[model samples]
Structures are given as structure tokens and as C-alpha cells.
Target: MSVLVYTESEQNKFKKAAFEVASYAKAVASQLGTTVTAVVINAEDTSELGNYGVDKVLKVSNSALDNFSAKTYASVLTEAAQSENAQVVILSSSADSKYLAPLLAIGLNAGYASNVVAAPLSTSPFKVKRSAFTNKAFEVTEIQSETKIIGVSNNSF
Candidate 1:
């Protein structure tokens, strides 16, 4: 299975967060011995994702998805993850991604973690270290689910 990164874009252009998530996912993929696949919606160009070590890009440009809907976007990401056999799903901690992360986790029945500051401590049990209480403290979460979802905090990398 590969690592899937949900890339957020607007006006047919990718945001900086997209690249960050892609780069993060690439590092995680390297640790997991898998490739990175980026899932983008309505992006005009996905070639730039390769610069972040994204091995593949899944671009969904459906007109119905032109507008942002958390539920709809989560569903699309879930489907893309399943199709890609994604063992790990990474997203930036943007407002939109925060809304989508939990929905996508529920859809995929995967364990979810937010504000992750670094790579996973372990992948077998899917242990991750994340910031808690607004970065005042830290928490190590162990995810037993087969798939794992991570939301990277803004500018935390």
C-alpha cells in the first residue's frame, strides 16, 4: 500500500500547504517503504507535486466538486485512498482539511491524529506524537487501525 496525501488547492493552483503535505507524506512513505500518491481536486497542474517526491497524482476535476463541501471532499478522498490502497493518509491542518480529516477517517475506519509534529514513532501499531492543548504539551497516540490518518499542523514542519 502507498501513502496518500490530500493536497488542497484553490483557483486551479496548489497552495503551499499542499507541497508541505506532499513532502511530509514522501518522508513517511520512505520510512514505510512505499510510494507517495497525491490526491488533488480540480487542480490545473499536478506535475509540481513530483518535486515533493510524489510518485503519482490523483486529480479529480468533477464539476460537482468544484465547490468545497467537507462531506463530499471526504468521500472523494476516501474513495481515492481505497483505490490507491493507502496505508497512511496525510493532510495539512488547514481549516478545510480539519473539517475533512475526521469525516475521511470515519469513512475509512482509520485512526486519526491531528497536529502531528513529526514522523510516526512507529508504524506497526501506528504510534504518533502530536501537539496537544495548543502545543503546550504533547501526546503520543497509538492507532491500531489498519489505515492511519494524520493532520500536520501549520508551519510545524
Candidate 2:
């Protein structure tokens, strides 16, 4: 299964976390023996999403997502991931992602990691490291389900 990294933009420019998410996804994809695909909504240019080392870009032209709302944004991105057959979804563990992370996991029926760091530890069993104790320590957690959703720290990659 492939990776789907969610990136956000502001005024046509890629958000700083966008590149950060891509970086993490690239590593996860490599460890999983699959490629990473990036998804951006209301982005000015889909080509720019490719700069992050993902295999392809999925740009959703949505005006509603131009303004941030966790539910709305998650809905759009969740659809994109499904269309791409994403087995693993990655995002920065920001406020928005915290809300979107759980929602998307429910929508996709994917296992969730809400505050994550590092790459997937095992491919067949699917384990990822995440921050515990308010980002103080790291824990290697297993998704335990078919699909995995991870919310990573912005610069952890």
C-alpha cells in the first residue's frame, strides 16, 4: 500500500508543514516498499506538490477548503486518499490535524496515531513511533488494523 501525505497551502504558497509532511511520508513509503503521493486542496499549482519527493500530486480544487475548517478539510482529503488507494495517511500533528486525524481514520476505517514521529518500524506488522508525554518521549505503537493514519510532528522528519 502507498502513502498519502496531506499538505496545506496559504494564498497559493505551500505551508511550511507541507514540506515537512512530505519529508516524513517519503521515508515511510520507502520503508513500506511503496511510493508517497501528496494531496493538497485549493492549491494554486499541483506541480508544486511534486517538489516534496512524492510519486504524484492529488489536487482538489475546493473553495470551501480555501478557509480552514477541520471537518470540511478532512472530508476533502479523506476522499482524495480513498481515490488514491492510500494504505497509510500522514499529516503534521497540528490543531487542525488533530481533529482531521481522528475523523479521517473513522471515515477510512484506518488505525490512527495522533501524535507521531519517525517512520514505520515494520511493514508487515506496521508499527510507527509517536511522541508520548507531551512530546517528551517516543513510543513505538502498532496500528493493529489494516490501514494506518499517522499525525506527525511538523519538523520531525
TM-score of each predicted structure versus truth: 0.96, 0.92
RMSD to true structure for each model, in Å: 0.9, 1.5
Top of the candidates by lDDT? 1
**Over 4 Å off, model 2:** none
Q: Against the hidden true structure, what lDDT does model 2 obtain?
A: 0.82
Q: Residue 102 of candidate 1: its Cα lDDT?
A: 91
Model 2 poorest ten-residue lDDT run: 43-52
Supply candidate 1's per-residue lDDT for 114: 91
Extract clashing residue pairs from model 2: none
lDDT of 2 by residue, 36-115 (tens): 88887777776755677788887778676777887887788788888888888998877778878888888889899877
TM-score of 2: 0.92
Rate residue 70 of model 1 by lDDT. 98
Best by TM-score: 1
Name the lDDT value of residue 76 in candidate 1.
96
